[model samples]
Structures are given as C-alpha cells and as structure tokens.
Target chain A: MFLLPWFLGLVFITLGPVLVSLYLSFTRYNILKPPRWIGLDNYVELFIWDPQFWAAVRVTFFFVGWSVPLVLVMSLGIAVLLNRGLSFLPVYRSIFYIPSLIGGSVAIGLLWREVFGSSGIVNQFLQGFGIATRSWVATPETAPWTLVSLNVWTFGAAMVIFLAALRQIPTSLYEAASIDGASAWTRFRRITLPLLTPVIFFNLILQVIHSFQAFTQSFIVSNGTGGPAESTLLYTLYLYQRAFVQLDMGYASAMAWVLLIVIAVFTGLLFWSARFWVYYGDG
Target chain B: MGLAVLVSAMMAGTMVPPAAAQDLSGEIRFSWWGSTVRNAKAESIISMFEKANPGVKVSREPGEWGSYWDKLTVQSASGNQPCAITMQSRWLAQYADPSILQPLDDKVASGELDVTGIDSAVLDSGRGSDGNLYFIPHGVFYFTLFMNKTAIEDAGMELPPDDWTWDDYAQYARDLSDKLPEGSYAVGNQGGAMDTFTDWVQSHGETLFTPEGEVGFTKQTVVDYFDFWEALRKDGVTETADQMAEIPDNIIDDTLLANGKILIDARPANQVDGHQKVLDAAMPGQELVIHSYPVGPSGTGEDIGSNGLAIGATCDENGTKLTEAWINFFTENPDAAATYSSDNGVVSVDRFRTAQLENPDTTPGQYQAVNMLSTVGPRAKSAYFPSGGYSALSGALTSAYETVAFEQSSSADAADKLIAQVKRLVRD
Candidate 1:
C-alpha cells in the first residue's frame, strides 16, 4: 500500500506521454497553441483524403513485404551456414553482423546513397558491365528496391540471433535424425526447423515492428523528400513530416497511434499463427 | 584532502564578490546550432559576453541543424526553453506563442535592443502572426544559382547573364546534359526544401499564400510550374526528385562542384562557403560563381529569408539585459561578426563590417558571394509571414511537382489535385 505512490508515478511517468499522444490523435494540436477537439477529423482526413499518408503506407508495406522475407531467409541461411564447422566462422559472423550494427544509422544511409547514386560505385560497376545506368535513386521502380537492399544487407543482427538459436538445438536431435536415415535437408527440416520456431517467431515479431517504425534510413536516404514520387517515404517518415515539418502535432499523433495499431495487429497475428508452426519443446 | 582543499581554494578565488553579484547569479543556459566553424565563433562570442557581464554565466548547448530543432521543440513543448536561443524566420511564428516564448516588444521599445542600423524589412521577418517581434535577424540571406564554370564551359556555352530567363536556362541545361558525361546531371534540385518551388512560384508571379491566408496561385499556375519541371525531367536535364533527394547535402555539393557531375546547384546566398568546399574538392583550379536566379515569367524576383536571435519572454530583467547585450555583441561587434560570417560565406548584417568582404584569406568564390549578395540584396524579396496551413500547401505543391516530374501523374492532374488539396487544407 505504501508503494502505491511509486507505482502510480511509474505508470503515469511511463505511460503518460503515450496516453496523451493517443488522445491528441483525435484533435487539432500544433504544439504552438492549445489543442482544439476535432473528434475523428484527423483520422477521417488520413483515411479518406491524404494521398501522402496513403503513399507512405504503401511504401512502408512494400518495404516490409520485400525486406522481411529477405531478412528472414538470408539471416537464417547465414546462421545455418555458420553452424557448420567452417574455418574462421567467428570472423565471418562478425563481418556479417557489422552491417546490421551500423545499418539503420545515418552513416549507413549516407553510404547507401553513395553506393546507389548516379555517380556512385554501383553505377560505375554497371558501366563496366556495359549497362548504361540512369538515376537509380531517381526511378520509382528502383528506389523502393534500394531501401529493401539496405534492410537485407543489414541481416547481421537477425543472423546473430538465429546463430544463437541454432546453437541451442541439442546435438542428440540431429543424431537421432541421422540414425533414422534422415537426409541433410530432411534433418534440417525435422530437427533444426522445429527447434528454431520459437526464435523465428520472436524474430518475426521484432523485424516487423522494426520495419514498421523505420524512419532514419529512408529519411536520410531520401533527404526527407521521399521521392521518385514518394516511393521511399515510409510511414514513420510521413509521421515525422506531419509532426515536425508540417507542425501538425495532432495529425502526427493520429498517424503515430495508427502505426501503433498496425504494429500491434501485425505482432498479434504473428503470435496467433505461432501456435500452428512455432513448436515449443516444453509444451 | 589536499586535492579537496586546493579545489576549494580555486573555487573561492573565482567566486563572484557579493557586492558585484546580482540576484541572477545561477547559470543561464543558451543554445544554438551551426557547423563546427560557427560553433567556435559562437563560443568565443559567448565568452566575450560573459567576461563583459560578471555574475551571469551563459552555458552553451549546440547541435547540428536538424537535431537542434527537434531537441529545442521537445524542450520548449515541455516548458523548458532556454532563456535565449537562435531560431529561423519560418519557425519564429510557432515558437513565439506567448504561452511558450516571452514577447520582446517592451525591450525593443525601451532601446534595450539596438535596431537602428538593422534593415527594417529584415526586422519584419521576425514579426509573428500577431504582429509582435519574436526574433531579430542575425544575417540576411537570398537564393542564387551556384555554377560550375568548367561544366558550363565544357558544354561549349558561355555563362548566362545575371538576368537570364528560365527558358534560356532550360536550353542551357539541355545543352549541358547532352554535352556532359553520360552519368552527369545538368542541374539538381534539392526537392526536400520548398525553396525551389517557392522560387518557381515567385517567378510566375504567384505567392505561396494569399493576402487573406489562402493559397495564392491558381490550378493553372501550379500546372505550369509542374510542367516546367516535368519537361526538365523528360529531357533528362535535371536529377529526379528521388535521385536528388538521396544525395546527401555534402555529396550533392561534391557532385556539382567536386566531381563535375552537375553543373549548377541552387542554395541560399550564405552557404557559398560550404559550396566552395565542394568546388575545391571537384575542381581545384576551376572558378565557382554565384549568379542571380533565373528570371521566371511573373518576375516576382528572388526570395530572401534569414535566421535570427531572440530573447525568450520568460527571462528576468537581468536575463533580458544580457540577451540584448549578446545580440548587440554578436551582430554589431564588427570583429566577432566578421570572424563568424567569414567562414559562413555570408556578408555580415552590419554594413560597416567589411572585413570578411575584404579579407585576403577569403576565397575568390566567397568574395564573389559577398558581392552577389550586396548587388542582389536590395532586390531580394523580404521575408513574409508564413501562410496558415502553409505546410500542407507546400507539401501538396512539392508532391504534385515530383509526381508530374517523375511521370507518375500529368501536370494538369497534379496541379488540379494540389489546388484542391491546398484549398481544403486551408479551409479546415
């Protein structure tokens, strides 16, 4: 009973801003002045009229659609490959993980720009192959791909987690598979795959959340223009534009809440479906 | 114990005398954002102010430009704005909300602020929507086209005159695009900022906002602007919005002046020094020049804006005095202004401070920028109040421009949509 104050403090301090943001989502607050209650006007505008918001949503989904699967497969593949008794495995692991460590940073975004820009290394390489490259960053078709490649290139963090999960699988499980005359592919499917389901579920939830809230790389990469016609404008980037650039804090709050709902729903869906495929040894 | 005694002795020696000490003895925090060069200059200026005024200490909090605003906004929203701070003209309106920032009218009227020599037009830039002066202009700025002489010369074209038309500029761009290396762009627009669009709109005799706070341009005017960019995009004369957007500011500088991948770039007049670095990198021997913006159909001429210093309303009397002194010291102190403005590639607002303009250490390009600003400064449009729903209007225009330029939508379609969007945005 004595700790009630502390508990209330913790709850209010931690959740106060979030609750305020949620409430502000329905109003017209520009941070400079008092918030005017506008009911669901902000949400209505976002859903019914705002093309930029829709563009951001489309770009975000495209980013997640391409990036999530690529990250999952590449990281899992790299982790599985590292699980083998390869020479200098630790060095390779570090090398693969380095991009992940720095991938979401402004520095990496700057690097991505350099690599894919018109006069960048990628263009120079393409020129060597007798391919005349125009602006990769300028094209609607290729700009989204550039962001996808950026996320895929940073598979290092997921790879590390997958590696740890791979290590946790008992050697006896593989041995049993081998005794049963299981092929390498079969053993991987029956033993390694099932055993790693929980980790996969965890990674899926994490990656989706990370991908949904991505802002820095796209912001930096696009220089806050989000172009070739808003192809690279992510959801968070739009939220930032609304919040800071436009100074429509209330609208930005609404967008933030919407994003929260999006992440929540996606995460919930992953957890719900986990029961179907995510095997738990304890259960 | 010996270390503690020594520390106490040093502190006691440095402690302010009670008779000399005012009631405001605690540290007063101040913040601004600028490059490392500007930061050093600011530090020196603050030190000078502190030395001149005892009992009051000013703490410096600075960051890079983008992060600086974010931090300051978050802080201000939480009722924690610094007593004195730097702000941009566009942002003064939002930040000067009486609830957040204290008004400076009393100080200005009492002659606490020396606004005698400052340009009245420039002073008006700091005025909020409520007609209260919220900030004071630190430096005046205008937009200009910084050109790579080698690239233009390489294209076998002479440099356009100071008053070249957009049509002539487009022709030159087309010629440059064809003549330059395959990977090179004729010109690149920084699509992120509204400067390019604003310049375009002004050239067409349209303003971003109307007198009554509506969008000034018609649907047709927007279409014409979009069409112009679309033509450039189709002709391969300009970098796509995505391409231009992806280029970091530094790399964009390098691409134009350093690598000669681009022949022309548009930037604020004050940024000539930074652009010179790009030129120095790409073309060490080549001369860089700042020319007037291409004349648009409307002939509204070039847009000029500024960043300025402001004293918060929350400051006490002593704080107010210190704020005035700081502003005077920073702006009117010829040597301090020269030192800061020299590296900044901008002319000091103080007309008497010719040190930067005449400095032997100043680059040829820097000197040219100074001359350009002086020559064009009088003609530049004074800063105006940002329109209500200006962000939405600007965003709609930018989106329309990009959409049309990238061939995702027709110019007419984009223009119509933009007009409708702006009307709706302003209406609400």
Candidate 2:
C-alpha cells in the first residue's frame, strides 16, 4: 500500500508519456491532426537528412564536453577552499549556491546577455584593459563559451555535495599522514584524492546527465532561434523548435528518443569506467 | 445644416446597430497577444462591448506574442480553444482548417458578421489556401524603415526622396556612415529579415511562394538579396554580425536602432509608436521618422499583412452567435475602435482610420503610421505565408545570413541551403 502512490506515479507520470513518445517517434504528428505512421522515416530524416540536427549535435557535445569538466573542477576547488575552516563559510556557501538554483532561469539568461552583449559590462571592463572583443553571446565562435561559462558558474550544487562528502572523510588518516611528515599536496594526492573519487564519480555522472538536458540558457540567450549561425543550438532547444515552432511533433519525438539513447550510452560508459576509478573505501 | 450632414455621414459609416447588441446573451472567451498597454485597451473595449450587449459576458485570455501560438495550438488540440482567437494572416494557413478555426464566409453572407467599410482586397487576404475566409481582419500592418531624424539633420544629410531606389539608399547609408558619431552604424543589419526579403522578392516581380505553395523565386534572387546587405555590412554601414545578432526581434528596447547605435532599420509600420517611445526614453532629444521602403527595380514591393480574429471550430450555435456579435462590435463599433487606437495594426475600417488621423490627440508616431498606411495600402501587395512557411523561412533566412556573415558559407551556398531547407519544411 505504501508503494502504491509511487507505482501510480511511475506508470502515469513517467512511463506512460515515455511509451506514447516512443510510438510517436515512428509517426507524423502535428498535434492538430491524427498521427500518421511513417515507419523509420522520421529516424532516417534525423540521422541522414537534417543539417540543423548535426549542428545541434555538434553544439551540444561541445557544450557538454567543456562544461562538465570545468564545472567538476571549479566546484571541487571551491568545496576544498570552503572546507579549510574559513570564516563566514555559511554566508559564502549560500552566496555561491544561489546561482545554481537560479542559473537555468530566464532572468539569468537575460542577465547573461546584458553581461556579454557588445555594449555590456564585460566589454566595458575589457576595454578598460585595452582588450577589444565583440559580443561574446552573439558570435558563433564565442556564444557557446558564454553558455559554458554559465554552466561553470552554477558549480555550487556539486560543491555542496563534495563538501558533505569531504566532511565524512576520517580526520585520523590525515593526522597519521601528518605524523609521517606528509606535505599538504602529498596528503591531498595520496589520501584525499583517493577518498573523494566516489563522490567525484557521483557528481560527474549527475552533471553529465544534467548538462545533456541543458536547454533554458541556450533558449534564452539565443532568443529561441538558436541563431548567430546555430552556435548555441543545444539538442533540447532543437527538439523544442522541431516540436513547437515547426509543429513537427513526430520528428521531435524521434530526436528525443535519440537523445535518450545517447544519454544512456554515456551513463553506461561512465558506470563501466567507475569500476577502475571510483573508491568507496571498501574492498 | 453642416452639423446635420456630418452626423448623417457618421451614422452611415457606423456598421453595428446599438439597439440590436442587447440581443446577445451568452458568454464567450476572446484571446489575444499583447503587452499590458494593449491588454488594458482590450479590456476597456471589452467593457464597452459588454455594456452594449447587456447580458453578454466575455472572459479575457491574454498572452505574449511568442508563446501565444504554442498555447493556442495546445488548446486547439484539446478542442478547448477560446471562442475568438487573435490570429495573424502570416499564421492563418496553419490553423485555417475547419477542424481548428470556423469558416466565416457563411456568417459574412448571413449578416452575422459585418465587415462593412473594410476593403474587399484586405478581406480577401484573410482567406485560407482552400479559399475559405478564416478570420475577420480588423487591422492591417505593413513594413517601413524608421530613421533617427535628429542624427540625419545633425549630419547635414537630406532624407531619401519618396521614390528612392535601393542603390540610392545604400549610397545614402554609406554617406551617413562617414558623418555619424564613432561606434554608431548607419543601419541595423536586415539581411536575415524575412519581411525585407519578401519585399525584395516582390519588388523584383517575383513571388515568395506560388498559389500552390512552392518556392517561387530563383536562387539568384536570394544571392542578390544577401549581397545587398553583405556589402553594407562589410563597409561598416551596418553593425557587425555579432552586434546585429544581438538585437532581438521582439524586444523594442534592446534594438540598436532604438538605442541610437544605428541610424535606420526596417520594422513594422504599426510599431513606430512603440519604437519611438523606446528611443525617446533611451536617448532623449532624438527624433524618429517613418519612411517607406526604397523602391525596387520594378516598383515598390511593399507588402502588408493583418492581425485579426478567428472563431474557434468548437463553438456551439449560441457561442458562435456571441462570437460573431463580439467581432462585429470589436470591428464596427466606433467607441471600441477609438479605445483600441490601432494598437495591433492600423484600423482596417476607413472611417476609424480617418477619425484616428484627424484626431489631434493622436501622437505623432500614430499619425505617421496612419498616414503611411493610407499611402501604402493601395499599392502594397498582400503577404501570404503558406502553412509553416513563416517559421521555416524565418529560421532559414537567419541561418543563411548568419552563415554568410560568420564566414561559414558563401552567399550562393547559404541561399542553396535556405531553399532546400524551406522546401523540406513547407512540403512536410
């Protein structure tokens, strides 16, 4: 009886729509008309025909590649710095954590635009140092970097997780290392790094999944067109355009399934690799 | 005698019978897309409408321009769309099917919907691919260039003549570029603007799409159009590709033209007042002027579209009657027209347009817009976008221009890609 609610949610909320979408992937549906089955045409068109699909793939992979590692490194670094018995730690922690909560919001997207726009604060600050550059969020080469920076800026959620895990690490091991005349860097390299691997693995998988699904930052920054030469065209944003703007619900469904498979493969690979790297401090 | 004649003319111009309005009894929902100002105006008009029809009730469903279509599409899929849906002619083909919007030709014939004083040509613009009238157009919109008059005067440059050509306009921009303040460009880059390209195609005596909805213009036309803006962009007459890309379509405040960072740009004629307000706030003492687009080789290719109301297919007999009555009141009632003040587009009815033009309270921007409509309405061709063509062309054009601007592709390759992508989207 206790599991009934969860079971119902699993069936209706998650599984039902997923199955419906899977069926829709093989059909031609415009939401207004009855769906017409087209077999593998939607998938074929996506894989072999659409240039925008390829552009979206390229942009998304680039975004995920740069953002995930940068986020992991920055968050781990911040967490370590904050863990050093610092004053006003909670205040700094809250200040840093706020961006993660609001980073995906429309307001942040607009703020990012204002900050990276040609006449924006970033340009003004750069011009002060004689570093002339065009609008970062508006150019093809630089637009994705702005979004990457946005993803990296929201590293606080991972930082909080790492901080909790760092707190759970035994102080006796560090004290023993100290008695053996271990340097701070050597202690970090030998004990701290090995102990933090599981938590790092957890954050890595979470961030990779999260980065793959990232939509709102690109949507807002690009104003939903994925413009400036499709530089900011994330995979989810392209799916949204296909479904809503062009009213190609079936094709969008196919794209969604493809994304699901890609994410699954990535997660599988991560898990497989974790056997070599992740340490739970157990035999 | 003159006063009596004037009163008679006014009464003859009015389309609705005030006494007959009280017969409408049922409730209906009227949905529209607008900002707070327009919503307030719409509410005032609805209040007037409800007052005229004592037993009638109207629930408002307001939305922003971008999300309005998505919301309406979802509501339509569920067969729960509002009785009256605000529709643009550009988007009419997508929803013109009888399954989505009701055919209003029978209503027009039966006198259920009165389109009196509206031009038949404008009315015909509302027809779908099946030749069925899907909506009653209450306002007409056309594109025009808005210039910073103060900047031009300061630079000692005279405005282009009424029959200025594209070459003349380009040279004018080039001339204006050398005299403008540093960091300001001559024009906003409009190479990707679908409306401007439509005008370009039309002016060259070619249609954007045929009656059967296929690509009507050649690839050469597309290349030439891209080259026109590319030259300006390369010469520093327009903003950099990055700066141009930064200027969003929907936000009036963020535009380079509005911020005085650019001298001229093409925008909808009806948006002059909004753009003027933004410019006025952003840079005080800057005067803005609306001008017709530069004429093409054949002639002026100015094209016009409309914002109008369509009755949803799901409405019952009574609901349909209420909707018809509301449409009649909204379009034909002089007070409602006065309240709306052509907020969406220029008033479609001749009498209301004349009234707005003659009214001293009309702002300079509104007066210029109404006058411009009067000037171009006769010559302007109806802009007809096929189902999904608007979104497809808009995306393709932006992509094509961005590729060219960012040096990813040549003009010819971009044009080829644009045509191919548009064909796939529209044919689908």
Clashing pairs in 1: A228-B242, B102-B313, B258-B282
- Top-lDDT structure, candidate number: 2
Q: C-alpha displacement of B141 in model 2, angstroms?
A: 0.5
lDDT of 1 by residue, A54-159 (tens): 8899999999998999999999998999999789999999999999889889999988877888878999999999997866776778988989999999999999
TM-score of each: 0.85, 0.95
Predicted model 1 interface RMSD = 3.1
Q: What's model 2's lDDT at B250?
A: 72
lDDT of 2 by residue, B1-428 (tens): 99999999888766457436348798999999999999999999998878878888999999998899999999999999999999999998889899999999998998878999999888988899999999999999899999999988888998888899989889999999999877899888889998899999999898888878898889999999999999999989999888879888678988888888888999998887788888889889999999989899889999899989999999998998889888988998888899999999999999999999899999999899999887899999886788888899989999899999988999999999999889878854
Model 1's DockQ score: 0.32
Q: Which window of ten consecutive residues has the lowest lDDT sum in model 2 chain B?
A: B13-22
Model 2 misplaced regions, further than 4 Å: B1-22
| Chain B TM-score, candidates in order | 0.85, 0.94
lDDT of each: 0.75, 0.91
lDDT of 1 by residue, B1-428 (tens): 99999999889875743223333344667888878878888888777667656666888988897688778777777777787788777656557667666666776788666665666777777777777888777776677787878668867878888777888878878877888777678887543346766777778777777545567767776666666666777677876565554455554454544456677878776566666666667767665677787888767467776677777656776666666677766666665676676443353364633566667877676677677766766666753545335466656666666676566778788888787767655532
RMSD, each candidate, Å?
A: 8.0, 3.0
